[model samples]
Target chain A: MSNTKLVLVYKGFERFWHWTQAFLIIFLAVTGFEIHSSFSLFGFETAVNLHNKAAWALIILIIFAIFWHITSGEWKQYLPTTKNLKAQIEFYLTGIFRNTPHPTKKTVLSKLNPLQRLVYLGLKILVIPVMVMSGLAYMFYRYPQAGIIKSANMEDLEVIAIIHTFGAFVLVAFVIVHLYLITTGHTITSNLNAMITGWEELEEDENEPSVNDEPVFVTEPKI
Target chain B: MQNFKPILTFLFAVIAPLVIITLALREPETDHELLNQLREKYTHQHKLGIDHSKLAILQQDFTNPHAITAACLSCHTERGQEVLKNAHWNWEREAFIPGRGVTYLGKKNLINNFCTGIASNEGTCNRCHTGYGWQDETFDFTNEYNIDCLICHDNTNTYEKQKGAAGYPVMGADSPDFRNIVGHVGRPGRYNCGYCHFHSAGGNNVKHGDLEMALLTADRTIDVHMGVDGLDMSCVECHPAENHQMLGRYYGVSSSNTQRATCEQCHGSVPHTNSKLNEHVVKVDCRTCHIPTYAKVNPTKTYWDWSTATKRQDGKPYELVDSVGNVSYASIKGNFHWQKMAKPEYYWFNGTADHHLISDKIDLNNLPMKINTMFGDYHDKQSKIVPMKVHRGKQPYDTENLTIIQPKLWDKEANQGALWIDLDWEKALEKGMEYLDMPYSGKHGFIETEMYLPISHMVSTSDQALSCVDCHTRNESRLANLTDFYMPGRDQNSTLDTIGKWLILLSLAGVLLHGIVRVFISRKNKIAETHK
Candidate 1:
């Protein structure tokens, strides 16, 4: 009667990428906040240099991620889906709080819920791209007439910057919700361990196909 | 042990306030006997009083062609005397129409250094304008020192007149001079600076911002030839009270360290928030940029568009060009004016950082007051910065008001160089092991990264090379952070703000109307359905 079923889904590189990107982004946000003088977690100048370096590192990681996703065809995992759309919405509104049974059972083949697929798709397509573009604009923009910067436009940076910061806030909010949802998966340790060790103990009954079917693909167990 | 004996002095200091209160309550004797002696020295030319008390130390013998023995004169040599000669003695300089009249000492200038006129800008400069005292309606500038000793010497003068002291309409006062003139801070200022600064005083409406020449007035022109002497301001307001051992000069090329609210007084924020640039603003001046002398102009007004900068009055050759091949020349004309012609010059971006940031022809004569010198100084007579900049050397930076600017390259470029690496071992190692190699490249353990050079804290524009990013970076560009925050440099969207406000109001009204209509329609629809 265990809710957990043994499944091998997440790969070693995926775990590595997820944790590294998370740490790097959190580091960047912390240092970036300090640079903005939102609060001085690190000293001002140090924060600025750290933020700049972190930005460069994030760019590099993004490039590597794009390559990894494309080569492994993992990028397709975030494509939007409508299966269990009603269940996903209901779960968010009521089931989540009441601990009702999940409408879409998770398996090695299709690890993400419908809502996650949709949100992750939007983030990859819309938010992250905008954040990188606007951040670049702020780092490199200028006016040539008045000798030195005629004005120091920092706070509500240009229009694009507002979009970039808004994207950042969304990412932060998603991270918060994502962490909470992670705890709801099977046994908390099982879901957490999958991200760390690339394996999850899933319910064996979830092998049954869903009403609106999605083909499940499981890899050979590494161990 | 000997110092401990002053208990009685400490007791007196504690009781001083009570003593002052007692004095205020009682009638005091008049000190007119001292005034008569001062009057005697003035009438007969006794060559005394320059070294008198700080309040009434009249510059009797200190006047030119006359000599005064002074604490300053004793130490300063001939060269020092020459330095001291600068109008440090000139308590004030007011703008006067040259045709009106002249002073009796073979001086044709009729400028009056009236207290309200020059130091404390009472704003109504017309009230203290020359020809006569506009305030009293009786005193004339053709005569001299009608306001008495406190007029120039005492920044704060409180006369006790309940029994015998002078009251307001009797003596004027300004609080502790920012210069701490004679080191008496915490004392009420003896004069009024607002008299010379306010716009009505015939000066710039504000001290900083958009370089509009319209604020320039006849009374506070930077050009001496334009009769700047008539303005309601003077030297000590910007310059320091203490000077070189030679009497009145300081060691630096810029004469004063005075902090002026002129810029921030109007511009909402302190520009000093930026360390590197703010330090430069302190060392240099506002004239380094907006001075018309830097702008190339045309000799004749006929075909000239002043904004295009077609000529320079310094007689120095100037070459300027626009994006296309449009060319113009900056030529020197005969009355020290610049002639204009369509000939292009080289761009400022040709070499490294602006080589022409400061023109070489520039020399610091009058130490820092460069107007019409062979150097490129805009001696603006009708300057927008009237009363303040016009009254130079008066408000030099105070030592007590220390503004420190500390700039570090660490924030923008995360990699620490050898110097910083040694200084911050923890962060360096934490960042990466790569931080260790910077210190000694030639030693057994070698590192290849660039050495960290600690630059002198001078904001001067040097001809050092810069990368493409230097110009491209937002922070480095002249379009400062406020550009995005406050519609660039101008109130560009203020009109838009009005439109936005009105739009909000209309939207609210429309929303209310729409809500009412929807409610009415829903009710009607509900009744019809019910009837059906």
Candidate 2:
């Protein structure tokens, strides 16, 4: 084995945010399914209370994550591009099976490949937003103090519940696919190790452009 | 194939919602023509078979209700005798109430949270009474001609009864001319029955939450049976009278006869087309699904605090109407809380109800005595979940004797110690007890009481029945209080659920393990190739 220099890929706050968000999501999904009467883990009333708390925690985590992404100029990692998209799809479908090289190279600045960008973009912009909005609508459906916005119609609530459930299934599907993809890295444990220690070994040729050499856009303008 | 997959996914995503919306928006096919033909046939069949013009006895100008009844008895000799035997005419019937043994209880003998009792106030209360001149205890119950036939059989809708007149139709100012008012005496319409039933306890739509004045010309949404656009059914359609004995029984009062009007009589035991919903019939009453709410048009009195009855310094009764225009405060009655479009409280009831009879001593320690308690539970075979309007009130009761006191609410004489006349509790209690010959402890205090009134009318359409999720959900279920039997969607098992979750997690781990093994094998092969 050749000597390799360890590099810090994930920032301290980013790791903290990611782990906290993951914990909250897992807690939410567990409590949420219990609230749906899928199981009797925490009893009904306790499940509902825990689910609501987890939901709020997730929302706060998402807010902090959003601020962090914008401030650190890391939001660009989820920008979708058509270039190498077909190749990336082919790599996942057939090339991965044949043990062929990845069509697109991953970098610190452009960590996500084309397909990853699209999927992550959809999650952030579409699925997550839809889940958040619908969840909030369900939570505050009734306003006792407000005379006008007193309660939602029962039929409308049924529709909201359907949409929320649909979003939940989508998220569950994404998580399942994500767990499978983590093993598709250079080595079986490479991706898992990178995420934990925030250091990853890069190919000699792929290491030409340092992460620091990337174009610096002002994340926060001076007042 | 790869390109085709996304295209198919996109197409399916676009078309699925469209198909769902189209199916949702599709109008349900109905045979309006057939419905119209059936309605026509029903209307023809329902036409009054009696021709009053042919009967020369009906053409006579009758001055009083008894005179009219006597004229009618000449042809229908047995009708008066049958009518005289009814509980409505006698105002007393023998019935066994649970907790209280077999006793003579009726509107006359039973004390209600509203109006207290009819013992001393028989003259005023007898306005709704079927027979005439029940002013005192000596009023003959055996008199056949005393029955006011027009109260139940009037078709002209001109029948009117005034308070303090002892069941006589109003004379002079409020009276309709008997000459023009005489018409074909047919089966009672909504107005005929509603005249006394709907307008009970004082004004129209005041007493019963289910029976409202709006039912006279209500739409299909208000009451499925009585609605003008629907069945347009009169009271006697369901409550058919055999020998002047009505088939229906009041909620609080126990019926003497076993014959009572039930939805199953017409709809059968299993009414719903869906077998699953039909299964619920054994446990749930028809009204629980049909009548989602009661008093749709007008509010009904739910809470009455009689302790608030205060008289003015001028010796006149003071009254206060709430913002909703309900009589909140009245010196004669007291503070009342009314509610509109009220959702009924659910209970398990097996036809019979146990009432706290006037003669029975109340357990004062169990404050807020249940004046009438509905009997049943989820486990009982005879019991079905029924909806009811739980009317709450604080009425005067004998503190020492621990019995509800009957106050003389009204009297014709000016200084007869009526509660409404002088607002004196002691004097009214003494007079009221003297009429019943029951001892009152002389010391009276207002005690909270509850009366359960079963809701049977104002049934909405089938589509308006509570949605499945309303009860099958985790929380806020209508049947949340009913926990004797396990409901599938609302309940879960800890052990089974845990095992199921573990199985799913184990399957996922197994898949991950398989993938890791494959990756490991491929890497080992690559390492061997590199060494070669």
Candidate 3:
């Protein structure tokens, strides 16, 4: 226990966003599947209304998160890196089984490992964008009328619907993998506790302080 | 962070419009104040400038229906010519049917599941025809005097055309006084249109399930538009006429989308206060939701098996009435099945239709032939899912010729080979074929057929309209049969669904396996450390 120190790895807004987004994703999945006629829980109409509201909330949160990421210089944390990518993969696949230490060290400056960077980047750039665009398309689909000028009208919803559904599937898969990966932290509940309390128990020797010689462990809350 | 400022701004520039447009373009809640303003501006009831009873020409005692028409032509000279070109008098109108070029299609040549056609049954069927003396092929169509002026125009509602009298007014002691009827001529009422339309195919509530005599005194529940307690609109209100050429054309006869009397004509496209409901207007017709069920009051004919005809009751044609007082079986007609408050079948229709012509060849193996195909699908941009009253029946068809037979149904002469009079299928078929001058095989058999009559009327109030679950449900959706397009809730791609389930399951399994391995390794490491 002396070899490790408690570090404020996740900022306050980061934790807030993480939990809020998690709730939204789960809420969206439940109501979305209901709208897809999976089961009748809240009923079709209520399910639709709730799903639409959750989608809008998620979109607004994403916009705020984007602004936060850029202004706080946190966007660079997700920048793609080939450095130790293969080792990270091997650590998850086999190294974890042998009880070897994690390949990547957790620091306040670099919160995500190389694989996390790629996967999170893919979700932000690809999956979430696709979901949002397709969802918007579904909402603003061109309806036929007499007076209005016809412009780039989407006649059929087949493509948009399929794409949206596929995005939903991908999102669900990501959430499942993400929940499971949380358990692979230093302790079984360490990752979950870190996300909740914005602090993680990190091995002292593994973490290197920033160029400014900032303390490795900080008691003060960030943002 | 400063280096990415422009990129962030650019991203926002792209996203801001999407959000703004979404909020802005939500069809502003149908302006009720504007709608009321427009309704008042457009729907003022028009009154005839001159009272017909005050006219000197109408004061004369009319002898016959033709004589009454002659006197009408004397006053309104060009009115006779206008009536001649009309579909009612002509019995057929030139229409550009898709795949069949410009052809004259109407009740004159249109073949239906019920009563077939009017080719050989001209004498009996012509009672509903707008003109007089269409008893046979020799009857003059050019004679403007033959057009019955009082049937549609008679405000008295006493004008009754006699059965098998070649469209003449009933002449016996029970005859309506034409002199009084001629004096009170006005615009066509619901009763005037209902006289023929409601009672087509030999009885009331037989043809169009949406239309019936109950509409004359309909409350809001029966019909929101025509309900006396509601809008109190007449047939001509929705279906207006210009120079006697009525705007609406029945899809049963007409093919093209032109001349349609749509709710959009008066109500406009976006008629709902809820923008979500309004959004569906593009893909779903107003009638689809408004008309949840048709034939609300009277049980319309749903099934008629002509093969079961010719059955004699005490050697005389007799009707068998069901418990509901509906004629279940008629020796003259066939086994009839009737239903009231019937849920309508839905179809993706773009106003255009393809009718089964009398001359078209039929494939007997492919039974339950569609008599009229409503042409549209999910892909068609103009198409919308419309509610329809699908009348199914088994009618006489030529076994050898593979064509539908127009049976001679009625005649005064017992020897003239009318099926109603003689109860003989062979003679009726032969005479009907002779009348049409079309090739017919002597052999006749019953073939399963269906006629799609779009339910446009009998609109219920918004509260009575179908809820989201009605058509958007996993099981027993009203649009269950229409699988051409994906409707959320109602339709889910089975392949995608299976893949989605597998993806989630596989991810769960992978995580569980990894978790167990990690737990075991941690425990092993703990034991080894303790042993050390």
lDDT winner among the candidates? Answer: 3
- The 10 consecutive residues of candidate 1 chain A with the worst lDDT sum are A210-219
TM-score attained by model 3? 0.90
Give the clashing residue pairs of candidate 3, or none. Answer: none
> B1-532 in candidate 1: lDDT tens per residue?
5434444553454335345544553434433454354335434421332433354333222221112223223333342333232232222222221232321211111111111012111112233221112222232433322222222333333311111111112222432232233223121121322222222212222211111232233222332111223322223322333331112211011112122223233222223333333332322233232232211111211111111222444643455543442333222110111222211111111000111001122222323322111111112211111111111111111122111101110221324421121323234222322221212112111011110111111111122222222222334422222132322112223444344345545645644554455456657878988999
What is the model-wide C-alpha lDDT for candidate 1? 0.36
**Positional deviation of residue B274's Cα in model 2 after best superposition, in angstroms:** 2.0
**Winner by DockQ:** 3
For model 3, what is the C-alpha lDDT against the true structure?
Answer: 0.85
* lDDT (C-alpha, whole model) for all candidates: 0.36, 0.75, 0.85
Candidate number that wins on DockQ, 1 or 3? 3
DockQ of 1: 0.02
N/CA/C clash count, model 2: 0
> Mind giving the per-residue lDDT tens digits that candidate 2 earns over B4-95?
66457644654354456546544345434544654575455377667865687777667676788887788888898888778888776777
State the displacement of the C-alpha of residue B21, model 1, in Å, after optimal TM-score superposition: 75
